[model samples]
Target: MSDRHMICPPKHVAIIMDGNGRWAKARGLPRSMGHRKGVEAVRETVRAAGDLGISYLTLYAFSSENWSRPEAEVNDLMGLLKAFIRRDLAELHRENVRIRIIGDRTNLRGDIMPLLLEAEETTRNNTGITLLIAFNYGARDEMVRAMRRLAAEVAAGTMSPDDITPARVSASLDTSGIPDPDLILRTSGEERLSNFLLWQAAYSELMFLPELWPDFTRETLIHAIERFQRRERRFGGVTAPSLAVGS
Candidate 1:
């Protein structure tokens, strides 16, 4: 496929930015250093997606289970996040990219929460591309939290339990208005989902790369996009139209 054309261009792309700690350890560097470098990769990937005409890009920045790491490391990661947003948010806005943070806000520090909100509000009107950061997120947790809210509303008679459905639950999710991922990429050769977006990735094409998060580049993204374009998405039922002969 050429840079101007692809076989299966995904409108939404989600990525699991993994292997930062391992990448750092291999180089005898602090984990924070790996995270700092990972930010550069984020910038590269976002620019590549925008250039490829992708409408939505989601990054698994932090997971709910990540709290199990050392307190110092967690603090450092949070600091890196704050710095990334503060420094890059303006440039991203100028590029017409909308920023949105998804995950459990209750676990975030009050001070950090405000910064996240500000980032989202700052680029809410942009129409070019959306950058979704999955911080302190877990797909299972999101589903559970949505269900709990629905249950509470039903208990209070403000909503009916019978009215609860997939659409309602989806609307309650942090990514309510956004479409589910069409392509999912994981770096560091990891094959697991890691509870990133279990429900949203039902039909997404999965691609695993051996490169660490910080090592990803525009070329890597282009290769992945090209590979994705070659696949035929049947979405269950009959075969793809491309496979139909004599049509």
Candidate 2:
């Protein structure tokens, strides 16, 4: 492989974009302004990831729990989503970015579903970076859905109970084709998974940054990548070579 291809960049990186509201409040601006700025950060991050050779970038866009927020906020968020797709779809397609969404579609607002579907269909054939958006997603809910599918298969006599395995379950997830993330980052000083990729993130390196989502820049992303590179990932095993030092 060429040096560019051999560079040790994570194959997949997932980010939880948090603290838009906090960022706006701190600046005495409307939350909507913060969300608007966050979109700019998203654009920059996507470009940086593609340039860095990261193959997959999954962003936690909106959780299912976010529906419980005030109706006005939800409407504004939905509007932003629609605007993003309408405005950026052509650019993303030209850049060869494949868009994928992982979340329940049932009961979605009539107009919203079509936009999400359009984004996926338009970029389905792209071979460049895959941008997986976790909209209306919850990790526990995803697990339950996967388990239910497995149970149905077993009940139909097509598969036995013992035939179920971790691999099978993973294949049933919305992210079946995508590789698991090597790094999962959350901004704004929060340090929790917040129900994102619970099964796939079993071994992901976590990074929590103090910078809010709107303030995240390319440098911040580079720093996070540097931090990840400095760590040793043993995948639940000790480093064999290191163990021989004292012998």
Candidate 3:
């Protein structure tokens, strides 16, 4: 039998790429150096995901809380982000991957926001793997923003407050059109969601790895997929096959 027969693949795989700064510190290099190298890992993982037939890949690129870092480090990260978007847009388009940015972007630098919008516009219609970059994102903030918007409509009498539900909140989120993640992977051995995707990860299978984001290779990603395959995601039920029979 083939790997496909034994492994259950996730249609949407979300990753929290952590430990760039720590990785760099361990190497006696600047944190920005780690981020720059992490971009290479991003490229490799994207290719691997496409080859593995994974449809959606959401990466936690930057969080709103990250802004609290030193000004120089924050600027450097933003610079790296801008460079990645500009350098990788054409290649990503060539791979037929649709690029999307999900976050509270109102406070982003004007220059970077325009480039991000341009990148999204250029690859909006591609039909391959969807690469969602969560920049300046915080799950709590996302929910609050959605609630505020809905509350405004309800107060205006344009929408009924009683009609609001999880579906409505989901639709109001930045990731409205995308499906919830089936599996969530966090590297660098961290074992927390860290406000990545609150509502969207209600039933996601999670895997934590010790490898830092800069050191993540295609092999590492493939191994994660392989591990994900071994899990029996019951999703609160007992429909999975019996392990004794499969073994």
Best-matching candidate per lDDT: 2
Candidate 1 lDDT score at position 86? 91
Error of 2 at 158 (Å): 0.8
The 0-to-1 C-alpha lDDT of every candidate, in the order given, reads 0.89, 0.92, 0.89
lDDT of 1 by residue, 1-247 (tens): 3343543468999999998889899999999899989988999899888888888999998899999999999899888888988998899999999999999998577478899899999999999889999988999999999889899999999999779988898899889999999899999998999998888888889999999999999889888988888887877856857767876
TM per model? 0.91, 0.95, 0.91
Q: Which 10-residue window of candidate 2 scores lowest in summed lDDT?
A: 1-10
Model 2, span 1-247: residue lDDT tens: 2223434689999999998999999999999999999999999999888888899999999999999999888899999888999999999999999999998878998598899999999999999999999999999999999999999999999999998999999999989978899999999999999999999999999999999999998778888988999999999988877687685
Tell me how many clashing residue pairs each candidate has. Answer: 1, 0, 0
Candidates arranged by lDDT, highest first: 2, 1, 3
- Candidate 3 clash figure, as a count: 0
Indicate the residue-level lDDT of 131 in model 1.
94
Residue ranges of candidate 3 with Cα displaced over 4 Å: 1-8, 240-247
Evaluated with TM-score, which candidate comes out highest? Answer: 2
**Clashing pairs in model 2?**
none
